[model samples]
Structures are given as C-alpha cells and as structure tokens.
Target: MIRFYHAPGTRGIRPIWLCEELGIDYGVEMIEFTKEFRASPAWRKISPLGKVPVLVDTADDLLMYESCAMVQYLLDRYGNGQLQPQLGTPEHAIYQQWNWFAESTFARPLGEIVNHGREFPGENLIPAVVAEMQNRGEQCAIAVGEAIADKAFILGDNFSAADINLGYSIMLAERFLSNGLPESIKPYWQRLSSRPAFIRATR
Candidate 1:
C-alpha cells in the first residue's frame, strides 16, 4: 500500500484528493505539524527538508516529498488515463502549465505570507511585506479567473488534475488574502469545492 505521511490542512490534500477521485487505496500517516517534530532526525530521514505530505509507495519502494510531483506520479502510475490530457499534446502542455502555475506562481506569495507571519510575528510583523504578498496572490487569483472566464475548468470543458492542483492553492488564497477571493473566482471556487472527492479528501 502507498503510505502518505501527512498533516491536516497541508499539501497532502492534493494527492489524497486525487486518490479519492481515482478510487485508489492508500494509507494516511498523520504526523505532528510542529517545527520540533519536523526538525527531528527521524522525520528528516523520510523528508530531507522535513516537509509534510511525504508519500511512500511501498509497492515500488519509492518515497516522494513534493506534493505536485506526487499528484503526477499517481496519475501516470495509477490514473489509467484519467484526469489528464494526452501526453505531448498542446492540451497537455496547458495542463502542465497550470499545474506549475498553481504551485509556483499562485502559491508562492501565499506561502510567503504564511512564512512571514510565522517567522516575524507580534510587533516584528511587517505590514508592507504582507500587503505586497497579498497583492501578488491577488494577481495570481485574477489570472486564474481570467483563464477560466468562460469555461467550467482551466482547460475549457474538462475537469482535469489541474483543477485539483489549483483547487488547493485557491483554498490557501481564500484563507490568506486580506480582501478574500475576487467575485470572478467565487463560482469557480464553489464548483471545485463542491466536488464529493474534494469534500471527502479535505474533511
């Protein structure tokens, strides 16, 4: 069985949601979401940087730390041609683009906001820095809204893993952004959040 070392409300939701969508069996190993635990030698052995959502595929004796990579790995290895476009096609390129954008571009500022708050809390917190990150995150959200303006999903009518990828980042934006999600994104957020798989995985 595939074992997922996870903490609640982390990137682990991405792969766990994919597994739910694909009906794949996996085990969840909840870990303490604390700096001390993450910095421990034992957890470091499993995850070099001590990140949550570490995936251990016992069947292949494989261990993965990156959440998006874990999503792609499960899709390619066990998805059976679901939740993705044909490889090497333009559609797949767009899919990959959005997947990377979801994490790298969209999630970057939100993560910075979080890190800034954690590292510089109380009087040391910088309002301008948080505001700047919020602006960047809002820009990313607007870009997503524009991309899905006339479509049900990022790639026109199809609901691919890109949605799953973006969904988690959007969830973070909703939590972090001071102004909250734009009106353009509310419907899309509702559509993605209402999925049974999403509900199950997140719950």
Candidate 2:
C-alpha cells in the first residue's frame, strides 16, 4: 500500500486531498505539528527542511517528499490523466503554470505572514513585515482572481490537480490575509473545499 506522512492544517493537506481525489487505497500517517520531531536525525534523512509532507511508496520501496511531486506521481501512475491536461499540450502547460504559481508565488507571502506571526507573536515582531506580507498576499490574490475570473475552476470547466494545488494555498491565504479572500476568490474556494475529497483530507 502507499503511505502518506502528513500534519493536519499544513501543506500536507494538498497531497491528502490528491490521494482522496484519486481514490487510491493508501495509508496516511498523521504526524503532529512539531519542528523538533521533524528535524530529528531520522526525519532529516527523508525531508531536509522538516516539512510536513513525506510520502513512502512501500510497494515500490520508494521514498519521496514534496507535495506537488506526489500529486504528479499519483496522476501519472494512477490517474489516467483524469484531473490534468494531456501532457505536452497547451492546456497542460497552463496547468503546470498554475501549479507552480500556487506554491512559488502565492504560498510564499502567506507563509511569511504565518512565520512572522508564529515566530514573534508580540510587538517584538515588526508590524511592517506582517503588513507587507499581507499586502503581497493580497496582490497574489488579485492575480488569482484574474486567472479564475468567471471560470468554475482554474483550468476552465474541468477540475484538475492544479485546483488541489492552488486551492490549498487559497485555504492558507484566507487565514494569513487580514482582509480576507477577495469576493471573486471565495466561490472558487467554495467549489474546491466542497469536494468530498477535500473534506475527508482536511479531517
């Protein structure tokens, strides 16, 4: 069986939702949110940065960690291209673009906001940094709004792993942005989060 190691309410949610969306028979190991345990020698061998998502494919004796990669693995090996565009197509390129945008662009400032608040809860933390992060996060949200404008999903009428990737970041953005999600973004999130797979993965 496939194994998924994750922590609730973290980036791990992306892979969990992907697995659920795929309907693959897999085992999920819910690790607590603890930096110490993740950074320990044993854990560091698998994940260099003590991240929450680590996937072990016992069937193939494979060890992989990166949530986006896991989603790609599941889709490539098991999906039959159900939730993504056909490889090498123009739409596929768009899919890849949004997936990268989710993690690289949008999630960054949101994570900064979280880290700044978490690492320094009091006035010791610079309010300017937090505000700046929030501003950047909102900017990212605007780009998302433009991308998702009038579309039921990111890549148009179809639902894809890109949605899982982008939607999960949107989930975190909601918490990080003090201004809340833009009106345009809320419906997209509602559509993604309403999935049974999303609900199951979140719990």
Candidate 3:
C-alpha cells in the first residue's frame, strides 16, 4: 500500500488529486503543520527538510519528499498512460514544461512571499520586498493565462497532470496575490477549481 504523510492545504494535494483521477487506492496520514512538529527528529527521519506530504510506498519500500515528484512518480508507476502524453513526444515535453513552470517558476515567488512573511512579520515586513515577489508571481500567472487562453487545459483540449501541478500554484496565487488572479485567468481558474477531482483532493 502507499502511505502519504499529508497536511491539509499543502502540496500533497497534487499527488492526492492524481490518485483520485486515476482511481488508485492510497492512504493519507495527516501530519502537524507546526514547525515544532516538523523539526522534530521523528519527522526529520521521514522528511529531511521537514516538509509536508511525504510519499512512502510500503510495497516497494520507497519514500519520496517533493510533492511534484510524487505526482510524476504516481503517474509513471500507476497512471497506465492516463493523464500524460506519449513519452518523448513534443506534447510530453510541453507537459513537463508546464509542470516545471508551475513549481519552479510560478510557485517560487509565492513561496518567497510566504517565507518573507514568516521571517519578517508584523511591522517588520517589507512592503517593497512583498511587492516585488507579487509582481513576479503575477507575471507568471499572466503567462499561464495567455498560454491557456484558447485551450481547455495547459496542453490544448486534453486534461493532463500538468493541470494538477499548475492548479496548486494557482491556488497559492489566489491566496497570496495582492489583487488575486487576473481577469483573463478567471474562467480557466473556474474550470480547474470546479473539477470533481480537484474538489475531492482539496477537501
């Protein structure tokens, strides 16, 4: 069986949603989101960086930390070619592109905003720094909006795991962006968020 160490509202949603979409049976172990708990030796043994959403495949004696990697792993191992394009194809390349963009590019600034707030709270928070990060995040959001302007999902009409990867980042943008998601992205956002899998994963 696969065991997922998860916390509500965390990146684990990416893999959890994938499991739901593919109808893969899995178990979730909710973890404390508190730093004190995360920093404990017990937690560190499972997650070196004390991050939430550790995936442990007891059947294979495998464990994984990065949430996005977990998503890819599940897709590769159990997806049976469901939510992705053919391997090594241009469409697959674009799929990988969007997945990376969702995490490394788009989620970076939003995470910084979060880190900045945690590191410098209350009056100590720097407005300029937050504004800069917000600008960067918004730029990524605009790029995503334009990319999917005419398509149903990130890679044209098909719904793929790339959507699951990008959806989490969009959720973060909605929470952290000063003005929230731009007007052009609203319809796309509605479509992604309204998906039954997304709703189940989030809940």
List TM-scores for all candidates, in order. 0.98, 0.95, 0.98
Q: Determine the backbone clash count of candidate 2.
A: 0
**Candidate with more favorable, higher TM-score: 1 or 3:** 1
- Candidate 1 residue pairs in backbone clash: none
lDDT of each: 0.94, 0.87, 0.92
Tens digits of lDDT, candidate 3, 79-143: 99989999999999999999999999999999999889988999999999999999999999999
Looking at model 3, residue 40 earns an lDDT score of: 99
**What does candidate 2 score on TM?**
0.95
Estimate the Cα RMSD of every predicted model relative to the unseen true structure: 0.7, 1.2, 0.9
Task: Pick out the ten consecutive residues of candidate 1 with the lowest summed lDDT.
Answer: 1-10
Relative to the true structure, candidate 1 reaches a TM of 0.98
Candidate 3 accuracy as TM-score: 0.98
lDDT of 2 by residue, 97-177 (tens): 999989889888998887787789887799899899889889888899888897999999999999999988899889988
Candidate 2 accuracy as lDDT: 0.87
Candidate 2 clashes between residue pairs 3 or more apart in a chain or in different chains? none
Give the per-residue lDDT digits (tens) of candidate 1, residues 74-150: 99999999999999999999999999999999999998998899899999999999999999999999999998899
lDDT: which candidate is best? 1
